[model samples]
Target chain A: MSDEIAILGAGMHPWGKWGHNFVQYGVAAAREALADAGVPWQDIKFVSGGATIRCGYPGFVAGATFAQALGWQGAEVNTSYAACASGSQALAAARNKILSGECDVALVVGADTTPKGFLAPAGGYRPEDPDWVRFYLGITNPTYFALYARRRIDLYGDTLEDFAAVKVKNSLVGSKNPRARYRKCFTAEDVAASAMVADPLRLMDICATSDGGAALIVSSLEYARKLGKPNAPRVAAISTVTPTFASGVLEMPDIATDSAAASGVEAHAYRSMIPLKAYEEAGIGPEDISLAEVYDLSTALELDWIEDLQLAPRGESAGLLRAGDTALGGKIPVNVSGGLACFGEAVPAQALSQICELTWQLRGEAGDRQVEGAQVGITANQGLFGHGSSVIVKK
Target chain B: MSAKPLAPAIEGWHTMQVKPHLIGSQCTECGTYFFPKQNDYCRNPHCNSTNFREVELSRTGKVWSYTNACYKPPAPFVAADPFVPYAIAGVQLETEQMVILGQVIEGLTVDDLKVGMPMELVLEALHETDDDIKVTWKWQPLTQ
Candidate 1:
């Protein structure tokens, strides 16, 4: 009678610039997930794919493309795209199907082959497009990350050392992760020595874009019980919410914040709002969370997410980092799969990759990166524009 | 070719004044402002009023935050040769109560500004097209 659905299995293709076709990675991860779930491809009643804009035409129609690539079995297909939140949205779609009595089992997959260096906007004098506008203004992706990272310094007295420490901690833990792309431990000096892309953020302070894939097999609780997965981890909540009006934080791809000049309307922090709904639906507070996976697009961003997740007090996340509370075996450890710090970003495949780490940790299969007795885990990410998501999983 | 005329980069986003103001549209009913001027509709969640009036945004604001770009951006950015790094600021306009982002005037860096510092808009050469110098609005520290 629970509203939660079962996470039957999780799998991933090692994240890196392998440079093969994205579909090949998707098939590999999908087959691995099916094998992990012990569910036949034909038994998958639904194919929910996180869409990739980089993979050419096939990426746009990802659900059917993946379905066809896996050998079509007449399964219902759905594809969801919300920039970086694509995987969470795809998982939300699968969860909806199961909870709505539409399907028993679903395969959720995402993969990408990204271009090296800065993800540039398309050409031409299109000033109307926000992406184009920002780029035209010399506001590259690191510009946004740097602004946020700089704010931490101005507001909280955070220092470059604290920022470097985040990279150091994530790199150390991520080194243990076989699936992580950058397993080499990064030191504060290494971070400081890197080229400065944006002030207060060195090249090491920012995450890289890499090619990778990840997948999950989710089923209705009833189907899980029938399959003898009664003890499997459950998808307790998924929140893919758009920002309320007057988004004050100046999200990426925008030239300005929503004007709060209108009387009686207020500017809202989009990142903080993403996880509140997930907590409400899961019937739990931050205290119940054992670990978290957040989008650390930049190292300082990990501190921002820790606060947004309410794991640490506002302006106190760096203190938590200093005290080791956010490291493995520490209180409410975050990004134990090394996070984007180690994995880099695979875009569509990245969010589900967080869920995969949670599934493994909850099942006590996380190897050395496991948080002891993890009962609940949360993942939070802010996609471009108005899209963002936070998902909660429980054992 | 050097005598080619200078023009607004994207056209009409800002004026050519020494103390320039970015052009935006305010929802007539809600008084909510939008940069690049949203003339089609209003975005105030409480009101669905479609009427909007083009208005000049506040000329000065406080720096909500700031940073600098150290690498050359890809076109259509049209960076200068040698790619001198330039500071960028997120200035919070008092009347609009919205933060607007723009590049800082040439030769300034993050070291030159801080959160809550006052800033004003100015016209600057964004990039030079073969046809003309494409200009854009940039933020300038009032202290400068």
Candidate 2:
């Protein structure tokens, strides 16, 4: 019951393409976080940064890079690269530092100035890399999303209308989010009229990549008391885990799977386990979650997360949508922050920014889209190459 | 790129190396199994244990889904040619309540694949690079 870390400050550099360096966005967000925390930059004891794939450098050392941008005060620094989960991982690293007494107060930042057009492979196309294979095979991210969407249709008997409903829900919420990249509400008819990005999936269904940054300042309970804000929002868990190799189901960004001839470990398919692990670590189950902020990389994915997160029975997510079980007034409000559908995917900054939304929702700061009487909130997101996942539970 | 026939990894084949076989996870909890084994941890939300054992997948499974690559794959994928059509599919395991994806072996055109058609897993020797023979796994419809 005593396991709690204070979320002293939360900040963002908005979510859009402004043609600025990623470090600038991160530093700006971090500075706002420090300011929000009512603490000086020199008072921060540690810095953790979520990584971004950068030119020349395989990974942008956000921790040290942002540290330098903010002027080094000799703070302990760390960097994490779990794709979209990078933000949560950065927050986790900072949390551990505070929990372990390695640091009393920490700064966590995530930012990305993504490339224009389709998120192509980083330069050279290596056939061995799944990311490259999917691209070269002409299997765009939308295509994989389509596969899952199609599967839902075939196996779960979902309809294209169900998919459109997802867009309608998230867009409605996103329209109210000032930090969201896409602020316009969309109707199911609008979704039906959109161009097809992949078979059965329209352009409106998929989330676009953008440039944005988000930051959070976390401190120990004692540190929060010293700052005069005795009651602060907390981060319960950060689940950035990988899939098991079993039957080696081919995940996105991968062509062939691990040969059953090799390691022989039973694969823990992510769709089923990833969210559960975070809930387990938080000592709460789906029934206890009051609200959720999930990675809706695609509209269909939001429905998938509904089942995967056990918000609804398997294959019943679409029905839940039709019945308004997941809407703002439903049993569990998901992605009340507008989600990726309206916010767009800002890659490295996505998952971390998701937690920022959770912080706001849990603290009853979400004005229009807030879940009524919200007590606990969760954030779910997955990144490429077994890189990211974050499930933050806050009350 | 030349059409080099895919060779099995078994002995007496044109290429060397044990056929790369598809692998997956078998649950001790409910007898459920999966390909691309869930090694990180047991996934069954109903089960709490992460204890999982690696098992060689069934050599044969039914075709659950199929698709064709109409364009050249990116670097690292062994494609020196452009617009070469290749067939791939999701194969359903008999024992595992899961489906695995792989390229259909050479000579087996997409026309030869059908959903629910029985297929067998095979190790396709990808390419010979000096001392190492890179191999991968594929699925082929069983001869009726």
Candidate 3:
């Protein structure tokens, strides 16, 4: 209804390790979105940027950095940082401004340039910082992922083959996506042959860090109608909720989980709670989702996200994977953009990229990898420090 | 390196004595616990008690989930020069009802551990410094 913001355009700079400044990728993606929307750059009133802390102080003020890079037009600027959910938070800010009638049209953008090898924390004896503590305890990012993957084997009876199949499935479609990186199709044997980074997770099973950017052009329904494009896809909901106190599982960079020992405090899975608000705000359910794009930081995580999104019953995503139900042309096609499997992760940009993929799918323009009759698409992603995000985009 | 005395890597995190238990704080009102010492505030959404007491955690717990680090981690980890991989576990303490992560004691692999198995806390050398042998808490799997 009136609460929703129209997605007039979506664009992305191909995901890869190009070794360029992150600003270039953001500018390129922004220009592409501007061109795609047929909206003049000068017409945009607000620029909401998702931030990547790795890029230094400029990255912290990314909205102004990108605005100045695009030549300032006195447009208002804002920056949001929620780890991987940064993009959704930025989009939510833009949506709020639009709904509040402070501005009719806004640009939502995110970009990143990641370092090579494992992401480690700053040095010194800083027990107060969780990142430093986890690293000191020798817990890297993949360790958490491997823990979840191991649970699939120990509890869900999922095999290493099931985990490898997820990589195989996503890699096949990623090969066809021009915007994706690491386009080579991977085999189960390839995954098996890859060196184990963590038990049950090989090098190929975990996504790499990359430099890429994604952006969106959104406007009020009235602005779209005035532009003679009334049928643009709309963002019905954007949920960026935090975990209830006493998180059930140990999340990234945390050595211990919140204790559920206190009376009346229940430990809950944070991932499952993310999508519930999106479904409520969108007035839709998991059954209504025709497709999904999720954070697959690890191959097994895709399965966990599928269940978390309620796309499948708990511990049953492997069946969907085995039955080819999560691939292109399946009943509920997932990650038609090949997920983080192909894209690795550009952090801030990756979340908005999920939205860009859904926008393309809903507009019936995703050539080769398009899900047929994709009327409703939802996205789920999680990051460190209790960042949980889900968004619904519908025709 | 000169011979040096042994010390807790970060002071007050745990006891240095043999069979050491992790040192944490508990909310005086709600019974919620925190590791790495949290004496400031209670995190229970239901309880906002500002009062907390220092407490020793249960020495033994059950394995909630486990994994290994096949590659050496970056700075602050202080991996050996040759880099030996180590298995890590998330153990659910009986009293805390919370899972804590730590390295499985030396000479063990993921193949040697299973979920829900009992484990006890122990002190091990995290790394050796010129002035001290830095020790941290580790989890030792109990025989089934």
Candidate 4:
């Protein structure tokens, strides 16, 4: 349908700690996307970029920062910060602009150069801030991840092996992805041997924070047709939804979940709502999705997201994995781009990177890891402070 | 020579007494409870009740899940010098059915806890400055 916004180009600056500024990575990805689209920088009518809080002032003004870096052609600029979901929010903004005819073609970019060691709160002692409060209470990100992982094991009968298998499967695919940060394939033994960061989650079970970037050039279908590329992959739906009140799910940066006793919980919890909303908007269901990419901040989270994506019945993701249903050639191959398991997390850039991989797979350009006859794909991610996003794309 | 007196890291969290209980807010109309006290308004989407009453949470709850920090968390989180790993748990209160996260009592590890185990709330020192001791709530397995 004409409702789709065409993804004319997708690009990334390899995922790793290069010790360079975030702008350099963003600019490199943007130039590659521009080149791939055969659309000159001056032709871009709008730009939406994700903000990285760690980069000081420039990170906050990412849209203008990237536009100026690419040689300001006077493009309209917008910046978004939804934590890890910032990239999806940026893409959603660009898609809306294209659909509304405010811009025929728009550039979307997200990049981050994370700090070394565990992610720390920005300087300041604001006791009222939940992020700071959690940190002060010794509630690290991995601590929360482990809480959920352990819950899955208790509730779903999932085992340590099931969690390790995810690392093994994703790392194998990551080994083939030159852009991924950790290329070496890992065995379950290797994952087990890694030091435990959080109980039930070993070092390898969690994704590392790294420096990387991803960019996309999107346009209206009519604009794509005018450019002589009629069959480009198009984003059918983008869901950037906040949690319903009294969300029972415990998310990051929050010390307690919303009280379900007051509002009465919805059928879908916070995490499940993102992709379900996208599916409804796309006029499709789980059965229609050819493949999926989801936020795998931890190995157990990947399995949890699989159920949230409705690819498997609740609490049965481990069964799906054991049966080889989520492998490369299995039903609904997930994280074919190696996910955060391999690429690590570049915060703002990570979600957009998922879309980049989907764009290539939908266009039949993914060489070794290509899902044969792939048509529809979905990307799901959740950011701290109640931001959840999902995007559906089709060829 | 005496050590400094202990204080709640953030005030109004709990009472410092023989039996310490977490102080929170309950929506008088909807009957939903919020820990860390939502003093402003009720979070219930279904009801627009601005009226809330402060209530002390149940002393005991079931463990929803638990984990331990094997590495020292970065700043803003004040860990002991020569950091020691600590355990954290999500305990679902008996009445509220809402899960609240807190550090487990000293010397307790993930191995000592299990999902659905009964736990009681207690006050523990989070860290200490030269002049004052910062205290926060912790979860402890109820002794039989």
Candidate 5:
């Protein structure tokens, strides 16, 4: 296990439609994390924050904004924006600082209050922007999710019933998570009865837009040992990779995929590379992961992530789910914190929340949803504009 | 006013013809193709050649996958007054070995689409204002 940088504490503001400022949620989560770590705000040497674009000026300079809100003590600050992977990028920035001895203690926070309905592109008419072009062509995120879902159905013989099962499973575990937005267990019937936001994807199959925050406190292992926390869980590795040349799969916001005519495609799908890089950096394989938290914007996507993470062989995620291997008590339980299905997506906060869940699981502090004897965990997600991230944490 | 001279929602994207085709860029050195036309450099990491030529993509392809929007998308996606959900398809062009996404023709729905079915490109109205009708390329499954 790598002990380069220790995760001293992890915390989050309960996710819901709380209708508060993003800064307020971020500050609350930050305070909770600092208290949990037993670190004074003034002791933190640096702060790295994830930006939420919808908010005005403060959103752009979130690191300084959060530091000011927490009463700045002249801590060095930085901010990162990678859409859904923003939090992971922020954590990566903090981890690098701690490991390099540039900062003894670092705080990483991400928070967002997502606007309701389809996430629109930043207001503009720049014809050069692919996001604007896709929007004008009426391609929403769910539409892309549906295309993938339909392809899976045709290629792998997956059924709508199988997709509903994912929601049912995640909701059951989500109901046990007090911080999750949706606390009620959903049956397959409930999922089937929900309205279809995009064909082949029902309301329950898709996660909601929510408001929330998540934060983490990290320090060098030496500092962690000096602080009387000799056994703190540590961030083993973080992967923030972009797509390979001529990536064959169609990703979000882009109307087309890279051409495969020149650089012939790889045997594995593009998304799988994200976690593979993390596994390499951690010197661990898929078999070493006891649990995982993956981006599940839609039910079909959870299955896609399963294959991408190599939890199961290609085209076998549905079989794994049907066999109960991905449930709370099964081999390699995924998304024990209810996932996006229950928490909804708070954008910048979502990826950090995944890390928090993994931290809790590794430390054996997850009350009801704990994966027994969990030692190593991984969090995997993709962001708009070709950003992909995966983080590995170990107890 | 001559039906407002139907204009493409974005220029340099598709040809204004009865049977429309997407315009893409081809790397002269590596033979790679790019939609929405990459002019900066050859995207193939192995090839650093910057030379490119504009080419019209194949008008016919096969459906890689398809889905329909059941809810009205948010702006700047223009929708009909009553907001009729529309089907979209990802078509794998036979020549370039790339998949491009576009809305299906007006009469087609998700029910009419199946993977690997042959499809052809056509031009259709995306949305209209009092003065002009914005057009975009769409996919239509060819009758077997």
Candidate 6:
């Protein structure tokens, strides 16, 4: 309804370890999306890729890879990598082109064949890279996440049950998703009994790495009408914003905090503000959002996302989960498509895939676990190295 | 040995944070801050002013969270052996209102740690060679 681009089609290769090349998955997803959109690949004026650093050389130039896989038409190609937010950045790139009238139809794709266990930085040692510094120092990813979980326990009085409940709520929804990697239901007991990956978080609490792909066909508002569906799912806003140093949020793969000794401004920490900004630009608030798909790399992280998304007040996300406010049948369902808790993380592709879930929800196409009467939806995720992202979609 | 500029200590060399802790830039007109210290300019889209200053963080804070590295980290991290258990701690500085993460000192395990425990940052040797020793700050329990 607002002046926004239209998501004519959304498609994803089943999210699992397919044991094939990332390009193959990306091509399959792209073809499905193009077919769904009723648009020919040759008509796509621009192509942007959410990169997969996991793929070595071919992953770096994902835009060209997908372009070549689809048969080279010389469309404008760009590949972006923002750790977890790569897919959202790709969506932003495509949307920007359409909004600026530089292109009418754009193809956006993100796919990855992730490594098993803890994701590590690319090979070699150079003290200069913070990621390498942290890893070399034996600072693993879960350790940082545990650090965040611990802080919540200290300052906010959160408990182990609160953390477990996040897995409970998400697992319930994840069981309904056929595309999910682990579709079994979980309980607080199950989470409590799971082996500790980090203090206060267990292996069940963490999302697994996966090999999967997701793609979308975005077009100008005028183009959507020309393609016959005047009322298609529209992308209201795409925000790929990062956090401010004043936030006091020390990110991972870094050895030190931003020196606050010089700047006296107490960091107004808002890593979750970007997504809300996108919602605001879309002229909607959390209450107005019928459902949501958020990054759930860890169960505790998902609760943090709930607070960060402003879906619930600070320190109250757990209560909302207990109240069934964020469950599939709740007033404002979250992760109705099982989120990353079920989907298994595909890295660069995950955030864009969240949008794909939103597109499905907003279009009233989500089977089994759909949020009833869904209208407005949002996808929220953060990428490492200062990438903050959110997207608002409305039917 | 004195600091011999160490093997580019962790690799893919270029920028490294040494004595001065990294901080980001913010727009006074519009509230926006960036870390890894945004050297380019203020990131707030609403305001374009580049009036920003550096801020040093607290050396001491409380442990917000922690986890041990049970698996050997992959490339770029120079390790002599396979994955050994190492602890990572997240510290929350009261003044900054942000949580920072780092490696716990060697020999420290989760059983020895608890949330809300006090921690202080200290620069310790990460790796050492004949000529240079790579030193980086890690979180250590105040009592330890």
Fnat of each prediction, in sequence: 0.85, 0.10, 0.87, 0.84, 0.85, 0.51
Residue A111 accuracy (lDDT) in model 2: 87
Query: How big is the positional error of residue B53 in model 1, measured in Å on the Cα after superposition?
Result: 0.6
Could you tell me how far off, in angstroms, the CA of residue A68 lies in candidate 6 after the best superposition?
1.7
**Could you tell me the TM-score of chain B in model 1?**
0.94
Rank by DockQ (best first): 1, 3, 5, 4, 6, 2
Higher-ranked by TM-score: 1 or 2: 1
Estimate candidate 3's alpha-carbon lDDT, on a 0 to 1 scale. Answer: 0.92
Question: TM for chain B in all models?
Answer: 0.94, 0.76, 0.94, 0.94, 0.95, 0.70
In model 4 chain B, which range of ten residues has the least summed lDDT?
B39-48
Residue A4 of model 2 has an lDDT of 70
- Taking the tens digit of each residue's C-alpha lDDT, what string does model 4 give over A1-395? 76789999999999999999999999999999999898999999999999999999999999999999999898999999988899999998998898888899999999999887777777677777888889889898998889989989989999999999999999988899989999999999999999999999999999999999999999999989999989999899999877777665667888987777754556346688888789998999999999999999999999999998899999999999999889889988999999999999999998899999999999888888898899999998988866778999998
Compared with the true structure, what per-residue lDDT tens digits does model 6 show for residues A1-395? 43699999988888887789999889988988999899999999999998887778889999988998899997999998888888888888888898888999999998999766566666654555777666766766676677677767766777888878778878787788777777889888998888887666788888888988899999998999999977889989888765654445656656445534334344444457686678778988877888878877788787788888888888778778778888889877888888888888888778878888888887888888888998998888877754568888988
Worst 10 residues of 4 chain A by lDDT: A261-270
Residue B96 of model 5, lDDT score: 94
lDDT string, candidate 3, A1-395, tens digits: 88999999998999999989999999999999999999999999999999989989989999999999999999999999889999999999999999999999999999999987777788888988999988987899999999999988999999999989989999998999999998999999999999999998999999999999999999999999999879999999999877788886889878998988888876567798889999999999999999999999999999999999999999999999999999898888888898999999998898899999999999999999989999999999987766679999999
Tens digits of per-residue lDDT for model 1 on A1-395?
37899999898999999989888888999999999999999999999998999879999988898999999889999999988999999999999899999999999999999987677888988978999999988998888888899999999999999999989989998999999999999888899999998898999999999999999999999999999999999999999877788887877988798989888986568788888889999999999999999999999999999998888889999999998988998887988999898998989899999999999999999998989999999999879985689999999
Worst 10 residues of 1 chain A by lDDT: A265-274
Q: In lDDT terms, how accurate is model 4?
A: 0.90
Task: After superposing candidate 6 on the true structure, give the runs of residues whose Cα lies further than 4 Å from its correct spot.
Answer: A263-266, B1-60, B75-86, B92-100, B105-116, B121-138
DockQ of 4: 0.74
- What stretches of model 3 exceed 4 Å from their correct place? B1-3
Q: Estimate the Cα RMSD of every predicted model relative to the unseen true structure.
A: 1.2, 6.2, 1.2, 1.6, 1.7, 5.2
- Give me the runs in candidate 2 sitting further than 4 Å from their true place: A122-128, A245-248, A258-267, B1-60, B65-88, B93-143
In Å, residue B81's CA in model 2 sits off its true spot by 12
| DockQ, each predicted model | 0.86, 0.13, 0.85, 0.74, 0.78, 0.32
TM-score of chain A as modeled in candidate 4: 0.98
